[model samples]
Target: MARSPQRLSGTPDDQTSPIPGRVTAPALRRGLDILELFLDSSEGLRVPEMTAALGIPRASTHELVGALVDRGYLQPKPGSAGQFVLGVKTFQLGGAYERSLDIVEAGREAARAVAAECGETVQIVVRDERVVVYIVRIDSTHSVRLVSDVGSRLPAHCTAGGKVLLASLSPEELATLFPDDTSLLPMTTRSIDTVERLNRELAETRERGWGEEYCESNQDVACVAAPVRNPRGECVAAMSISIPTIRWQDDKRADYVALVSTGARELSTRLGARL
Candidate 1:
């Protein structure tokens, strides 16, 4: 089957962008890009800073910066002079993302169910810049267990949810996603140490439609994960459970695996996935 055309650059810089009648103007896109960097840093950015952050020419950045400041997208901070911060409009724009009800509704149901069934921590993550962004978390029942929070970033190669997400991606896509000679950061001694090993493991995950982690992130933690696919059958996210190695023995282990699999399938069903 043919895949629908997606905007590769996401910049909306093309003259023939989308429906042909509408296109993202260069100044609007650059201004938005410059405005986005504010969320990542504590200090406000200057024209020279924006130029360096975007790699756009200093002349163009200066003009865009001026336009943004004039339009109230960027304003001066109280304590800092010459440094410009995100204005009211910027936050107002971000409020729209906060108001998004679907993501909240989906996450609330998923977090509660997974945590209730497994009696352990569960997280739903979205891939962001070769890392998994932990968006929701449900705490464990036991005193000794894994803990994670929303807005935390973890390596994609070392976590059960991350590996399941990786398995859903194509090799070509992986190559495009990861930087050259990417360093495989090991959280524990058992973390996959090389591209070759990680590749092989992800392949197995794809085949099984599930992922398992044995002290890969922490020496005492064990986890199993399965994907929550979308209506299109693409793995959009994952549901997982964390268990202490001491509890992951015998029939207890089987119970953990079964719970994770069933929970993931249920989440996928809620997402409108057929399988």
Candidate 2:
């Protein structure tokens, strides 16, 4: 019978080992590193393997693993005494994380339904400090839909959804997010070019309860967006529809605005917002 290979004692300065001195909790850091190790492993890990890979003392490794087991973060592998794997609690936490996201449950269905209804690309965006991130996207059947995909980031001043999200922030938050007025970088000739212009646009967006972008993020695309709110009336996201400029008509702007605003409202209601 072939024997299993022994776990090698990794060097202290090795790339895999978490560097010390940055955090105050050594034991907690070790525990987190141990958990991260499984991201690279397909099988359960043993105490000796953890100790060797992390360069932690055997007793400390055992104690940390034992504590994790007691907390239900780790469990002994089935039929393998001394080997451990992530526990049900870890999966439970992951599920909770997924469920707690308002967009995951409410925003996705709305985006899909709206895209199908309008035959245009629908997007869900969230503001990340100074930029807007596309969290979800539902594509249109048309061949000329916006090329931006989920996880794409763009300057807040240049996109309809970004403007909607930025409009939701308080004055202080806005000041903090854009400490330097020059940070509002224009993406195209039509994009908001200065902080003063962007602020005026955002104020108008707040008043109208919607935002519009034409040839801003993309020269060939035009977008309309509205804000989505959480239960506490906090704006959590923005939902938008993008259409090719060549296919856009001045007469259809109202209809497009109505569709996006309705989608945003429905998603916000699903997220427990009163409106």
Candidate 3:
């Protein structure tokens, strides 16, 4: 099944090659195809599964997988007979990538600067299931402390960063996350429960380039967040700042939003995010 030239332009990223030409480069395509297979399957992959999935002959699969294993792209499972999974070398390559713009590194500088400048807690979060997990945080030096820590997961609809990230997705994608429609539990009275309402808020966040939560996750705090995107121009993370309701209502409210949005944008820039 071959396609005309025009259709090839929109070929999926998973595809290994472009239309056949000098640019096709068959070996490079095969190598990329092998690598892309691991993206969706982090778990153990057997020889047969690789062979079947790629429609490659048994001998070819063995050679490809073997070459990959020897090159440290794949590793043999400990207990399994001959199954392979992504290797530490792959992770090292990924780690180099992670370190290049590292959310933690970039995030720390922005978070700390924002916290110091604005006197509020700044945090960087990444999406995890129906929630967003706090990965890096910089707390304000104020006398009053907010209750949050890294590695902690909070409901997506209940927090500013979570809302911003969730809103980045489309209606169809959101539905896939919460199929029952009732899977969204309200953490506070202000949490968005209805899909329609959440959708509206998400649209607003996208337009404004930021999001907000008023006593949603925590009844006494107000939070603001903006999306963090990767080099590929996809939202990869979020950065936020939370202020206690008392201070949040003060004359500094306008300044807080500006400071937080600045921090978010700074972190996004370091992460290679654009627009």
Clashes of each: 0, 0, 0
lDDT of 3: 0.78
C-alpha lDDT values of all predictions = 0.76, 0.84, 0.78
Listed in order, each prediction's TM-score against the native is: 0.60, 0.63, 0.62
Q: Could you arrange the candidates by TM-score from highest to lowest?
A: 2, 3, 1
Writing each residue's lDDT as its tens digit, candidate 3 over 1-111 gives 111112233432234344544355444455556666776575777877766666657787788778888888889989988877888888787667756666777788888
In candidate 1, list every pair of residues with a backbone clash.
none
Count: clashes, candidate 1: 0
Assess the local accuracy of residue 262 in candidate 2 as a C-alpha lDDT between 0 and 100: 95
Encode model 2's per-residue lDDT on 1-275: one tens digit a residue.
11222222243333332345442355666777787776556588998988877777999989989999999989999999899989888878766754686676577899989998899999999988889899999998898777877899999779999999999888888887776767778788888877788789999999999999999989999999999997668988899999999899989999999999999999988876667
Residue 94, candidate 2: C-alpha displacement in angstroms? 20
Displacement of the residue 110 alpha carbon in candidate 1, Å: 2.7
Q: Which stretches of candidate 3 lie over 4 Å from their true place?
A: 1-99
